[model samples]
Target: MLIHPEEILETINMVTHEHLDIRTVTMGINLRGCSHPDVATFNENIYSRIMRCAENLVRTTEDIQSLYGIPIINKRISVTPIAIVAESCQVDDYCSVAETLDRAAQQAGIDFIGGFSALVQKGMTPGDLKLINSIPQALATTKKVCSSVNVATTKAGINMDAVAMMGHIIKQTAELTRDRAGIGCAKLVIFANAPDDNPFMAGAFHGIGEPDCVINVGVSGPGVVNSAVRALQNPSLGDISECIKKTAFKITRMGEMVGKEVARRLNAQFGVLDLSLAPTPAVGDSVAAILEAMGLESCGTHGTTAALALLNDAVKKGGAMASSSVGGLSGAFIPVSEDEGMIRAVQRGSLSLDKLEAMTCVCSVGLDMIAVPGDTSPATISAIIADEMAIGMINKKTTAVRIIPAPGTKVGDMVEFGGLLGTAPVMPVHNFSSETFIARGGRIPAPIQSLTN
Candidate 1:
């Protein structure tokens, strides 16, 4: 990849003005080898392995950031799901392991470490149940550990039992951290069809098939894409899509270069370049702004989904052309709290829980960073997860929910989770109950499309 002077200048402009940056460079470490029959030994093994593998992760990323003058917002690590690695241990509680992970991450100067996770898309093992049970305590105690559970997949159908369990778990997590406005739940996510190479947080994990250690990069440039769309005047929808595609191509190329360099310096394999238009709370750097620039008065209005569909599709197409290693959730993200435009839309009544759910059908992820009334029932949360899972299962795409039921907060109330998590307004759910539906806890069979394989 030869760099021309003009291309360099354009990239600098994007970084300096448009908020283009590598969102995260996650180091995935396989912890399958760290399992042991003794819980104490198991903890020691994982702690030692992480310290050895990621000893220089932070320094290496910092060096690269300085060299290229590109912002790398987070340096993280993803390990094999704890349920798989800790199943061999005798102890039932995995909170101890979560603490060990937190220590390793902090000592190594990492921002966050993912893979405190379990994959129960089909069914839960005894170990999975144990880890799931420990999530509330683990998250409430740890500062940098993130947990995710995959309760449904296109091949395995929906595990309604796990879905129901997570509702209660999330509630417990919130109550335990009520002083912080349920910030712990912000670090936990429930997913359907979770990806192995995702570098983003609250939902990233190292899959069974991944290498021992690899570097995966998540590139975010919603501002650049928004600029491209707004630059076109009196253009057709096709023209808007073409502009997004071209912008995505440049972003992907830059991301791949940075990822490969980071991997090379650390002596790790370069995994994938995720071209997700992840947004921050900053103005002019939002996915919702991109949609509004396409001529909509506000996000979540009619034709919002269609605009999102165009954006997601064009992003994927352009990213695919730029690199064979385009993986993870490579499309536009619509986390309401994280995007300033989305926050405004919610406050102004242009966005709602139902509208966000519908938008998830075409976006990369589902119903992310949402806040609901503290009194919302656990069964209702399960039903919300079930609904998002169904969309991902049917479409064979990745969808997740990171909702906060802030204690003592109601609709129209604001919950502040500063930094990358951002603040969210409490959104309303349906008046009717989904308790009866969620109470019938069993696996929802896979769709007919699963028969293809």
Candidate 2:
């Protein structure tokens, strides 16, 4: 069978003109067998396993990119969460493990290596606590290692104590990398209902249940959707939704095709295709721009949330039609630093922390890439996260917090992380304290909505 000419041309236009591309092709490797009684042997085994599994990853992806002429932006790896795998070891910290992972990633030409993480939705074990404590040092020392902590899930409810601790951890991470405007915080994500097979970094982890090895693809194209929305002549909201759905279908088709090709080449199981409208720092490629094209005065205006909900639902519908293997945080991301339109909106007073939180209720993830004041208290940060986690629990959806306390930076200051992470303006937070409420360390019971059984 031959490729359809019209479809081929359409894809070319999407890539060469509209900025559609495969955001990441991540290899998920199970490292359970690498665990050993001796920490040194354990580290060696871990490194060797990763290198063996992903040795050809970068070269294979490059070959596929040339073969298909699609831009595969990042080649990454997600391993089994280090906490569980390293639990038997007597080491006090996982910093050495993080270094080994970083070295392995560099050798394999991986852009980011995820799974330095812990799951403490209900409570923290010794391993979990150690991993959490070591995160600041681990992340601070490594270049490519990404970290995440899941402190809440829908059924088990929010872990307020862990939430409180992460606030301090985030601050410490920021301080550790303060010379770079706390860019380390950008690599750390705290989650409620975080997915296992996500291809995106700062949150990607090969779940304990996932296969030994698999390839997951992240497809991104906020620009294409923006163009499609703007192409409609005086379109209504319904028209815009249909347009977005159609665009998402096309983008996802490109993703599924690329992912299959890459998996076939790499001899790996094809995992999910994450169709998130993840924006870059580039001018035209922005999720917030797509929102603006949908007749929003600004990204955080009254109808912005409704418009986002529609866009998100329509994108999901379209992507589902294109592929059955859709997973991860597959929705439009509203990260302030990552999207130029979002940054502009914040700079112009059209968006704020409250409005972003409101928007997250209807989308995937929460308060991503938002920069708060330097002096923002850890209790306050924890309170912000508690509110977000509650939303996820009640709605039975995934939500994450990746806010940065830009050290020595206050409101109206701009933090430059550069490249794909972009830059963020320090947005104002509510001065009122949530101190006492956050200090009351206890689990918030799962909402009735979580009782789907």
Candidate 1: list runs displaced more than 4 Å. Answer: 1-6
Whole-model Cα lDDT of every candidate shown, in order: 0.94, 0.92
Which window of ten consecutive residues has the lowest lDDT sum in model 1?
Answer: 7-16
- Stretches of candidate 2 above 4 Å error? 1-6
* Per-residue alpha-carbon lDDT of candidate 2 for residues 1-453, written as tens digits (9 for 90 to 100): 889999888889989988899999999999999988688999999999999999999999999899989999999999999999998888999899999999999999989999999999999999899999999888889999999999999999999999999989999999999888888899999999989999998899999789989999999999999988988999988898889999999889889998998888888999999999999988889988998998888888889999999999999999999999999989988899999999999988999899999999998888899899999999989988998998888888899999999999999999999889989999988899988988899899777777888
What RMSD, rounded to one decimal, does every model reach?
1.1, 1.1
TM-score versus the correct structure, for each prediction: 0.98, 0.98
Q: Return the lDDT, model 2, position 300.
A: 84
Per-residue accuracy of model 1 over 154-205 as CA lDDT, tens digit each: 9999999999999999999999999999999999999999999999998989
With a 3 Å backbone cut-off (N, CA, C), the pairs that clash in candidate 2 are none
Q: Clashes per prediction?
A: 0, 0
